[model samples]
Target: MIKCNNVQEQAQDLCGEIFERWRELLQSGEFILGDQVLAFESWMSDRCGGAHAVALNSGTDALFLALRALDIGPGDEVITCANTFVATVGAIVAVGARPILADVGDDELLSVETIAPLVTDRTKAVIPVYLRGRPLDIDPIIDLCRSRGVAVIEDCAQAIGTMIDGRQVGTRADASAFSMHPLKTLGGLGDGGMLVTRDPGIAEYARIARNHGLENRNESIRFGINSRLDSLQAAALNIKAQYLDQWLKRRVEIAAFYDDVLSTTRTGTDLGRGKPGNAYYHYVVQSTHRDELQAYLAENDVQAAIHYPVPIHWQKAWLSSQPRIALPTTERLSRQMITLPCHHHLSDGDVEKVVTLIKQFERAVRW
Candidate 1:
């Protein structure tokens, strides 16, 4: 069976190094905000073009902290894509701000064109999510936000190590949030996240806020949440970080194969192929027969999935709170896109099988 990702195999491969680090942490007794976490943060900073990286418990918290550090709260409005993971919009709500959903381009990512019309006097920040690890040409978005005095907090949960013009995506924003959930490109053993920024003030505020606003053991400067990254997970992440580029390269290779073959199909079409620096977090294709194709893959022991079956604006949880808006591209893409397994673990034969099965399904549906 060709699965989305062979996480266990990757974990097992790194167990020896992870266990060694775990044993060291166990003996040292310095758990929270310890050496392991610092080491990982240092690596992240260097990789993300010298940004100050603040390690946190989760990516959602990373976004929330970025908003908090920027003093974006009640009465402020945050603009983000409607097609992104719920975390992107949820972070705005978590910080007591109103989330404004923006439509996406053909690349399934937010652009200045889609977002410019929605900006208003209350706009506090713009979180352009690098969905599916496809890096946005963010300079224009940054320019747009900068001219209006709005902050750019990139939602980089899926796009770690993705570069644009030889620089990483996270470095260009006011602050960027990255997730290390087990499924992410730079995933650790468990949940972990990082906030990257060039601003020392934002970094300092996040560092202070993440530890319950602790200036010291007995001092509390302000009310804050406990969002510290675990030392054990950081230790595991430090080990996994070494192989991230290798894994990403493999994923790109797989994506290229899928793009080459899937482009000719009458029933399915690949999106966002020509974009450079795409990390290919999910190899997505749009097909009118999405449900049928997914079932066919499952029957053949080839696992396929949906990145998102529903857009955020349509989600029942936010229906009443969210303004009724039309996101034509987002709504249509959600129903048509199917995510195929595009991971480092898949062999050449596994990829070929997936493509073959999809083509077979395409042929069968022609009638």
Candidate 2:
């Protein structure tokens, strides 16, 4: 059976370099905020077009730190898509802020139009997630936020290398958080994340905050959390970073084939949001019979999944805390979308098989 990603095979291809770096990292004994982490951060910041990059233990912490840097707490309101991963909403709650939902469009992107009404005087930041690796056409959103003096902290957990208008997406926002949770386009061997910002002050604050507010070896500048990114994982990422572009290219190729075959149906873009640079984190399609289609794929030995089966607004966790938020688009899209395995490890023939299975399921449903 063709797996979603043959991670072991992909890693084995680079184990020689990773183990060599590992041996060096062990010798240095600067495990925490050491040379490996600094090297990865330097290379990463350059790639992200950020003035600084703050590496952390997880993407959840990255978002939380970004929020903390902006001083979003207590009654401050944060606007984000209702269809995004729970981490996006959880981060706001983690920082003691309220998470307001914005509906998404057919593109699975939350736009300025959808978010405009939700903004208010208490709006501290808007975390527009680049869902499914396609960066939102966020110029309008940024312009609106800037007019009101609201911060735009883009949730770029999915789109590390995505570009819009010849520049990287992370560079477009005041700050953006990226995940390397072994599943992202630039995945690490384990959980890892980074926060990038153009502002030196925010960068400095986040950097210090990630290390328990340490000003010096033993001095505490403020109350902070321990969320530093591991050097070992950084070493692994350094090895994998070399092949990110190559792997992304393969993912794009697979996405193109899926797009052509699934075009007649309700499918998300393979290349993503009218750009060749999206990370293609997930190749998703909208199927009214989503549950049936998923089961069919399973029977056929194809592992299809869902980005989210339910919108965050409707989740028991959110609805219980807050009143029902009206988000028809988010709710509908959640039920309709089905994620197919389009990882770099799959061959062209594997992709063809996935498409064929879905087409067969659709035909069976029609009959």
Candidate 3:
């Protein structure tokens, strides 16, 4: 069966170089905040068009640090999209802020129009996630936040290399957090994350926050947490960083192929699909017959999944006893979305096979 992503195959292709670097790092014993970590941070900062980048243990840490740098805590509310991964909301709540979810656009990214209504006097920040590697419209969001004196923290977990109009995603917000989980566009072999900021003070504060609130190695000036990136993971990430552009290109090529085939197959019907603007982390398309198509694909030897089957507010953990406000767009998206394979490692033949299987399923169900 064709899997959604094939990280093992990609790792195998570079194992020799990866292992050589890993062995060297193990022997060095300079683990935390070492040369490997510094080099990776510099490389990532340059790539993301930021003056400073702080490497952390995970993407969730990156978000938490960014919030801490901005001094966001209890009594503050952070506006974010209801359509994003729960981690986005989790980070805000973990930092003692209330996550005020707003509706996302049909494209599955945060919409500035929906955000305005959610902001209140207690709202301290807005996190617009680049969901599925698609860039959200950042300029307006930035402008809106700036006008209101609120911080903008971009959740760029899936959009490591995505660019809008001309600028990169991380460069657009006050600060951006990127996840290097195995499934991300610029994923490392193990977990890793980075925080990018143009503000020097914010960068400095985040650096201290990632460690234990130490103003310096010998000084503990404030409360902080231990969230440093492992040197071994940095070594693996440095090697992977060298090939990120090529991987991004291949993903774009595969997405184009899917678009060509799926569009033709949908001819007169409304599949509710749009041409993706960047890397296809997940080639999600909307349909009323989502369940039928999913089961059909499974029978035809193609593995498919959903980006999110439940909106944040509907999750039992997040629900309250009070009657919930209706979020029509978020509800529709949860039921209609289905993601197909669109990874860098997929061959042209793989793309063709996936498309063929999907078309067969659509026809069999008369969708």
| Model 2 TM-score, all chains together | 0.95
Candidate 2 residue-wise lDDT, 166-209, digit = tens = 66678677888999888787888899999988898988998999
RMSD each, Å: 1.2, 1.7, 2.1
Poorest 10 consecutive residues by lDDT, candidate 3: 267-276
Candidate number that wins on TM-score, 1 or 2: 1
- Model 1 scores a C-alpha lDDT of 0.89
Steric clash pairs (candidate 3):
none
Per-residue lDDT of candidate 1, residues 204-289 (tens digit) = 99999999899999999987899999999999999999998899889888888887887888644457765888888887888888
- Give per-candidate clash totals: 0, 0, 0
Q: Cα miss at 288, model 3 (Å)?
A: 1.4
**CA displacement after TM-score superposition, residue 52 of candidate 1 (Å):** 0.2
Total clashing pairs in model 2:
0
Model 3 stretches astray by more than 4 angstroms: 267-277, 320-323
For each candidate, what TM-score against the reference? 0.97, 0.95, 0.95
lDDT on C-alpha atoms for all candidate structures: 0.89, 0.84, 0.82
Model 1: how far residue 231 lies from native, Å: 0.1
By lDDT, the better pick of 1 and 2 is: 1
Query: Local error of candidate 2 at 325, Å?
Result: 1.8
